[model samples]
Target: MLGGLHFWFEIRIFMHFIKKRRNKPLYKKFLPLRKNVQNRNKLLWFRKKKWQKFQRAFSRLKKKKLHDPKSYFLSTFKNFFSRKFKYNLQNKQRLSLFYGGFRKKYLKRVVKSTLKEFKSLNKHVTVLFIEKLETRLDTALYRTHFSYSFKNARQLISHKKVYVNNKVVQHNSYLLKKGDVITLDKDVFNFVILNILDSEMWPIPPKHFYVNYKTLQILVIEDIHYTNCLMYYPFWIDFNSFLKFYER
Candidate 1:
């Protein structure tokens, strides 16, 4: 029951952030649920992936069964959302938000922004768009194994422990640019070294970041230009469809 509550709390926060991206401040401390949080098992998150998957799949399957699609399970195996291309666009938008940690408004904004910046899609703007997301502080931290999870990375940033270019930036959405250097507060840096550095989480940091475990620092090497960014998630979503989702 406690594990269930924690999982829901995280989902709630994610959904809330997307809905009120700029309108509202986050309720990091909850008056109503503070009691539950106080007793939460810190280790429960280690198994959270399995737990979340089970709950989400079971609930979604139950709903699908109740709705009774025309083709039933066939619809799932092959384009369950719809046969139309529009469904692909929607799915890509959703997956990009869910996996990339983008808000709805921000997701569309990113799409439009990238379109204008590149001035066309011929530059493989989809890859560039994904590159932007990966450069976000929280996502970069998670990728580099600086933090155990995205939420953890966000918490560290919000606590003013993470620094970029020698300045503390609380927003996890802060974008890292080429030549920007990242470091953590001394106490937090030592703590990370004591725990995370030796954890074999990611044995090798990707080439795009110059990580010095000894210095407790990370430097943006060059803007990564990898198309395989989408492969990071277990599921499939087409970036091309995401691009098409925008009005041509």
Candidate 2:
């Protein structure tokens, strides 16, 4: 009877083990289905949020009177013209500042002549013109080790202490052309050489220009190209828009 009881107990335990194993498949199948449902719901929620964001942006744009084609075009044109006018005014002010201390009429004449020259050169006023202005005798002196600053270079020129092609130039705006040779007076040369040795003011020369440190002279070997000028002084003025606004 004890053996029969033991056998019955073993059978009961075996049946329990089989019953648990059969339930495992059901748990596995239902658990994965539940997780898949959760993932699908999460994806839907994310898509709904993205759609809401897009809707808000669209509503804002519509409220700004941008939904109508004619209104959109008019608003765009107004903004463009306003910005262009403001830039042109700033350019005029810069030109006036460049000729500072000169008579207003003379400044206006210079601006007009410069604009006319730009119009005659290319359909767009290229950066080469700006480079020409920047590489003038006084400007070059300031850029090289000859002068402490551009103002100092201008003062030196005005005092007849600077020469180009072996002739003294009093005007600071005298643009240096290709193949021009620049030299300094003996006194100014000695003074600047001493300063250069004392200070760490040595800057690389411009690509088209070369400076002889030994002889204290500069030579413009080539003309300033548009590509090179753009690399140096980049301006935000759009050439096509500038031409259209000026009716050039």
lDDT of each: 0.61, 0.56
How many residue pairs clash (N, CA or C atoms closer than 3 angstroms) in each of the candidate models, in the order given? 0, 0
Report the C-alpha lDDT of model 1 over 4-101, residue by residue, as the tens digit. 99999999999988997654222222121111111122322335554553333333333223222121121232564465554554454445433434
Candidate 1 lDDT at 228 equals 48
Give the per-residue lDDT of model 2 (tens digit) for 1-248: 99999999999999999998774421122121111110111222334553554333233333223212122111122577686666564444333332222345553454455677776676235453355466667778866758755666788899898889999999887888889999989978778887567545433456887888999989989866666553332122233343344443
Model 1 — TM-score against the truth? Answer: 0.61
TM-score of 2: 0.51
Worst ten in a row by lDDT for model 1: 30-39
Candidate 2 lDDT: 0.56
Best by TM-score: 1
Model 2 regions lying over 4 Å from their true place:
1-86, 89-111, 114-124, 194-203, 234-248
Candidate 2 least-lDDT 10 residues: 32-41
